[model samples]
Target: MGVLLDSFGPALWLVLSPTNLVIMVLGIIAGTILGALPGFGAAQALALMFPFTFGMTPEAGVLFFIAIYAAAEYGGSIPAILIRTPGTSAAAITVLDGYPMARAGKASRALKISLYTGVVGSIASSFIFLFAASGLAWIGLQFGPSEMFAVGIFGLSVIGSFFGDSPVKGFVATGIGLFLAMIGSSGFSGLRFTFGQASLLDGMPLIVVIIGFLAMPEVFRLMAARRGDDPEVASLGGENREANHVGLKVMRKLVPTMVRSTLIGTAVGAIPGPGATVSSLLAYSEEKRFSKHPEKFGTGIDEGVAAPETANNAVVAGSLIPSLALGVPGSGAIAILLGLLISKGIVPGPLLFQQNGPLVMAVFAGLIVSAVLMLVVGIAGVRVFALVARVPRYMLAPFVLMLLVIGTYAYHNYAAHIVIAILIGAFAYWLETIRVPVIPIVLAFVMAPIIEANLNRAMVIHGGDLSFALTRPITLIILGLAVLSIVLGFFRARRARHESAAAKENLGETP
Candidate 1:
């Protein structure tokens, strides 16, 4: 806590500098554009932009990416409002009220509501993150190897449980990631799965794997999608143009909904799974339940839009809590952020505040600035973002592919990395086709080394006695949590499947 206070001044200075501020604005603009495009999102944007950050100072890069992250959350609602297409998964809930509002000639109102609440949520969430992350870090500092290993296991279990409709598939994907992580030489054991390739000596490059899974597959999905004219965005109605500005009264009225949603988002995000998508869903449902006119939620109301939008944006900061404190990324986009930090030789976790206090503080400051700037940028360039949404997926595909190639190759200037990325990307696309979640794979891969290293250390200290973990209260608690998480995931999956089947059956009988 002292470290945070001591470094915050310098961190603020670094982030507020003119050069870094420019990076923040540009990143917000870029993120907003990409996020407003259907089928593109923060993870893809970050993956594509990875190479460009190589030349930046760590603080600047972190700030830039954080700006993109915050802006993308808001950007996602743009298409949801303008064209009834959710630009990101988190925005799907927004489509409920957003599209209806747009159809009713309230498109501007919906967008502004999303923008304003998103900024407020993000800023508020960042503050929660500031205190919460530091506290988590302090707790983590007390964890031994056994506890840390258990924590890692808990993270993977929770992530797997929440990833897809079926925990089975999610676990399978996690296994695949674990296998991929085992490819390099295990300092104690010789090469496990390198297959005699010298390049495998260092294991899979995080950059290449990240690009393959997050960026390339998106391009594949885009290009493989059936060719057609792009969906046209509905025009902003004349009345909407005349009354686009959201009055302060509307903002005042939705404050409670925004506050509730922000809290929900922060809590859920700190748990290391579910992320903005689930948070938004939960927030929207809760708001409906709390609303005076619940029936009007999907029919288009300010509260409906505010609730989900606020939650999803708040998730931008909330998701970082676990990532910064526990070295466990909450989502794929967060994995990218941690990957960058690692590449810069800045390890995340409890010690990070001690070793890189200023940098960590910079991240916190950057998040706040980005949240504020996202609102400004969103308001100024909304029309342009709406037009960008009209771009054909096919046209965007080639450019994205080019970026995938360039970014992958630039990481190490290794041609093999490009080939590996292509193969992994193709594999990822196949997995997607089978409804297998890719994010669990990324999370597990990122966590594998940490888990393995800690588990090995724990074993060495305990003379290979697994029973020692049973004696450690912290380790036992974490392991118990992991078990509970898996159980919960199984039930959630079963319930989701039942609900889906029922919905389909009802649809079939409707007409």
Candidate 2:
């Protein structure tokens, strides 16, 4: 404890400095503005902001990015409450009750509940990041090649568990991602998959692929649809201040729901692929089960707003755990953030602690500071954000396309990347039509090369004996766990079907 305390002392001091504080404020405001805009989110913001971090030290770069991460999550709930449109995909569940509250003349009240829960969840997740990081990194060091490969497979299994009755399509998407990972020159072999195109030698630039996936799909959707009128800043039927105030009595009632949602969000975030969308939905479902008035969940209830808002924001910190401690990104945006860490000469995982101990603590301090900034900055600018959230998709889509083109081309100063990003964007947009799980595809692509390199190295060491790879104690443990996880998932899926059928039968009997 003394050693930990001494190490954290310098990092704490860094967070208190004026420069870092100023950057935190800037990130919060920028993230709120960008995130509150329809069809713009963390991925687009991170990609667009990636160039700005090129010259900073790794510690400061990470601090700035995390502030964007924490604040953007809270910002998403703004449009979700007032306009029946989710600013981010994870906020989709918030629209269920949030819009209803607005229509019923309590939009401001719903916004306050969302803001308060988001902060509480972020604070809780930051504490978890601070205390749990070292232990998680230590455990990550225990993984051998086989163990890591098993871990990747476990992450992929989320595709089946989450796709809601369709595992085949998810696996198909995973296969494509693996194929993308196999592009470029084969590492120790003199062969390449570039098809004689010179620009393909480097595989796809990470930024290009990210832009294609995030920016392109959003733009296409906006272009094809008729743009709706943006909502009014005053979300209520009338500007009644009394109905929009969340007093102590209501806050006291919401405390238990927020606590439960925080725990759920942190757990889901630590896992690699399920992300905030799943966490919010799961928390919403569980909150209903735990509620005294379960039927009121989608009926403009404050608890409904609080449950999902807290879980999704908590996921911001939760998703960082695997990326920082295990060197495996928890989501696509974090994968992009991981690329930034590598570019800055800071490799994540166990070695990170040994090589850059102070930087690790600085990261923790940054998260704590971001949580404080979110509370102050979010409330102060709520009105401005509400106004900005009304920006039309038609005007915004063209601006996003410009960002995608410039960000891709400037990253490597290659026009080829711009073309590649557009092509991939078109492909990714098509994948959305089929309900493919794109994030898992990107994650598998990133992990495939790592898994391949390690597996081959292990095989050569064991004289071409594949069975010897399974003999490592850590590898065996992860394999066992993987099997157990699949079994549990199968049963859980079956139970859900049974419950759904039983509900239908009960309804029939009542009629």
Candidate 3:
């Protein structure tokens, strides 16, 4: 306890410094702008800012990134509510109810609810991070390669369930992502895949691939949909509508939903894969199930806004559990953070905690401060962010595309990477039209190499005996869970179809 307290003191002091405080504030503000803008996301924002952080101390650099992450999760909801366009993929669930509320002239109320829920959820999860992270690290230390591979498989399977209506499409996307991951030089053989071009010798850069597949495509899609008409701006009410109107009563009413979503978010975050999108979707569904009047959910109720907002924001801290403890990132933003950590000569496994305990504690402390900063900035600037809804899509699209191009090129200073990004963007656009979920593809790309390499290593160590996978208790348990998840997903889909049919019959009879 004494050692822990001693370690925490430096972190606490570091976060309290005026310079670090300014960084946090600026990061949050920048993240909010990026998140509120169409075609910009946390991953892109972080990737764009990576070069700028190269000169800072590792502690300050990481804190800056965390601030952006925490703020962006909340900031995405602004556009989600005001424009029916999710600024980040995690905000997709928010649009279900948030946009509806805005159309009903309750945009300010909905935004306030989301901001408050985010602040509370973040604070709650920070406690989880402080207390539970060490225990999770202990458990992670016990995991062998077989168990790790199984965990990766479980993550890919969960992605299938989380994506849209078609599990087949999701799986296909996952398979493609895995195949893309195989393009790189193999660790064991040092051989490249399908490489005729010399430029492919180094394989695709993860940052480049992510930026191309996720960010650039969205930019193109937005540009394609550009129009000349000015967007209608929603006004935050005048003097009577003081920001403080988001009071204790509202917090009291939202407490149950907030707590439930936070728990769900934390649990999902602790999982090896699947990130904020899954957490938000699950929380939204659970809220719908427990609501007294389910019909009011999508029509724009406070509960609807609270559920997804709280859940997604909570994911900011939750994702770090796997990344910090296990050397695995559960989301794209964390994946970028993992790269940044690597660049800073910090390995993410157990050694990270051992070698840089104070830095880790400082990161946790920064997260807490960032969350508080998000609330302060969000409340004070709700009206300003709402104004972003009025930006012309034409102007925004070009600037976003330009950033994507520059960021991708700067990652390696290779014109080939820029061309690859454009090509991937076109391919992604085509894939989207076919109703494939890009999330599984991204997860598959991230996890495939990890799974394959670990599986091979485990096999080699076990004298090539396949039974080694089941011989390990952790691996066996994870396999069982994966099987159970598939079974449950099948039943859920069937039940949903039955309910749909029954609702149709009832409507026909009543008419």
Candidate 4:
């Protein structure tokens, strides 16, 4: 309590400062614009902001990035509600009902509800971070290399959810990603998959590959399919003005749903894995299950938009709990933020609050301010951003390509990196045709290094004894869970196959 009181003044003063306030609003504006654009994400938006923040004070830079992170998460729902296309994976669940509402000529109402819920969730989650982060930091310090390895495995276990339809394809995609991660040289200075290319020494540029995998395929698909007509864009201008505003009565009814989804989002985010994508989906599912009229869920319902939008946007603050309290990141965007903090010499752990108390408080203050800014900016800009839906594929495509090119170059400034992005983008585009989404691959690529490095260290610590690595209590528990999950997943798959075959046989006999 004393520490909190001491930090309050510094936090408030920094937040209200002329420079930080201006930068925070600017970051929110950039975040909303980026989030409104399909295929753009918080990590990419932060990457774009990186070069600019490089010269600022640590407080200023961190504040700018935090605003962007919070706002972008909220921003993703804008496109999702206005059109079927979700701007980020975090907003994917919103499309189920948001687009439906838009189709029903209530795009403005959907956007307003989304903004309202986003701010509410953001505030709720921030309170959790404020009060809980310190306590969580203790658990974070207990992690060793072995424990981290186990955590990575647990993260990988989410492959079942990623490939809920076909475990084989999911594993295949994961294998591809792991193989890609192994491309660079060993710590002992031996090359693995370089194939004699000098640029391969660094393995692959993650930013370039990510941009390529996400952007190129979509671009190629758009060009080849010539998505000449987007009815949502044309229809936005014709939405009913009277139905555009969400009524006070309607807002009152969604209060419970908002609270429930915020709690779910905060819980999901506090854990090591199961990011915003899962949070929003779980919230949406729970909302539907508990609704008096479940049948009305997918048919332009306000609760549908509210639940997912609230949950996902809440993930921004919820995710920060782990990132600030522990070195472990909550999501890919947070992973990037982790790297940024390390580069700037701001180590995150139990000691972070003790050592950098004011900075931490400033971040908390920034998050609250940003949430308010996101709501205000979103309300004012909804009509303007709705204009994005009307953008022709021909115009949007070239502009996105240009941004991708620039983003890819911004990483290490290597020309060869740009070429690799081109090749990977082209490959990912073809991969999509086979119903193989690149998400599993991307997720695996992100974790492969963490798993490999940690596992190696754990073995080395125990003199190369595999059993010795498994002896620690935390490692043992996590690895046990990972093994149990894998076994369960396998059994479930077998059972599903058997049931499917029996159903097929029965259908054949019935005919």
Poorest stretch of ten by lDDT in candidate 1: 229-238
Looking at model 4, which ten-residue stretch has the lowest summed lDDT? 158-167
Please write out the lDDT profile of model 2 over residues 172-285, one tens digit for every residue: 776777788777877546546788888898887555654566457766865664545434322444367788787788889889998999888887777665577667866776
lDDT of model 4 at position 451: 81
Query: Using lDDT as the measure, what is the rank order of every candidate, best first?
Result: 1, 3, 4, 2
lDDT of 3 by residue, 307-420 (tens): 989998888888888788779886778999888888889899767777788988888888889988888888789777555444555656777677667766766688998888
Model 3 segments beyond 4 Å from truth?
2-14, 17-20, 26-115, 132-134, 187-195, 198-221, 224-363, 505-511
Better of 1 and 3 by TM-score: 3
Question: Number of clashing residue pairs in every model?
Answer: 0, 0, 0, 0
Off by over 4 Å in 4: 17-20, 33-62, 72-118, 187-189, 226-359, 487-511
Tens digits of per-residue lDDT for model 1, 245-331: 687887899889988999988876775645777678668867875777754766888898999899998887877877887897877
lDDT to native, each model: 0.78, 0.71, 0.76, 0.75
RMSD (Cα, Å) of model 4: 5.5
Model 2: worst 10 consecutive residues (lDDT sum): 229-238
- Give lDDT: candidate 1, residue 341: 94
TM-score of each: 0.61, 0.63, 0.71, 0.73
After TM-score superposition, what is the CA distance of residue 302 in candidate 4 from its true location, in Å? 8.7
